[model samples]
Target: MPIPACPVVHFELPYRDAARVSTFYQTVFGWQLQPMGPEMGNYILATTSTCDSSAPDALRGSINGGLFPLVPESPLQQPSVVLGVPDVREAMARVSAAGGQVLGEPMAIPGVGDYVVFVDPEGNRLSMLQPLMG
Candidate 1:
């Protein structure tokens, strides 16, 4: 049996200036940006494509993302992709066994799921997410 596929479901970018970054993407690419409240770390949700909730696979091949404030001490303050997995812990173990470094423990995103950041062997930052089931 082949291993299950983990698809890139989202992208993230760090922004020094929220207003500038939000305006750039919105004006240039027509992305819809929704700024979250402080409870959500002031993250800006970027919707690059439309999807119908009532339809299955409505977001196939498309993804939405978030813009987070850049933290000087954070190594993950760079553009990265988020891969969806069935189990975040299992995926973290696999990443470590494959010579990647799991940065820290998984953090829960409200209404989303468990998420963790990691770095590949080549030092590329990425994340894995076990989405919450309805």
Candidate 2:
């Protein structure tokens, strides 16, 4: 289950004001935004469900990602770069075997897909997705 080194990571939206932008996304895309931490009022990750709202992050009902405040110092690259895989767990192993590091664990998203974030050996941020059956 070794996935080739894909060229995409994720589509990141740069927001100057997270609260304002996150609210907009919640209404427009039906995405759920959870506060990253108390100290990070302006920092939040967009999700497909609220805490205790639905299936695990990997089993959610649809493809989804996060929303965070824009950091001027960070690199700028947004291009709908989420990679689709057949099995996240397997993909994670393949990635690791290929010298990649898992940025996060596989998350279920109800009937949508399962996914995880990782970094390649070349320092590229990416995500792996496996759509779940309805």
Best by TM-score: 1
Q: Which candidate is the best by lDDT?
A: 1
- lDDT per residue (tens digit) for residues 38-124 in model 2: 454444666654433554555433444555566678653332346877667878888899999987678775555887777779877
lDDT of 1 by residue, 19-114 (tens): 999999999998999999789998999998876354764655688999999999967688999999999999999999999999999999989999
lDDT of each: 0.92, 0.65
Distance from true location, Cα of 92 in model 2, Å: 0.6
> Which regions of candidate 1 are displaced past 4 Å?
53-60
Clashing pairs in 1: none
TM-score per prediction, in order, is 0.92, 0.49
Off by over 4 Å in 2: 1-10, 19-66, 69-80
**Per-residue lDDT value at 122 in model 2:** 82
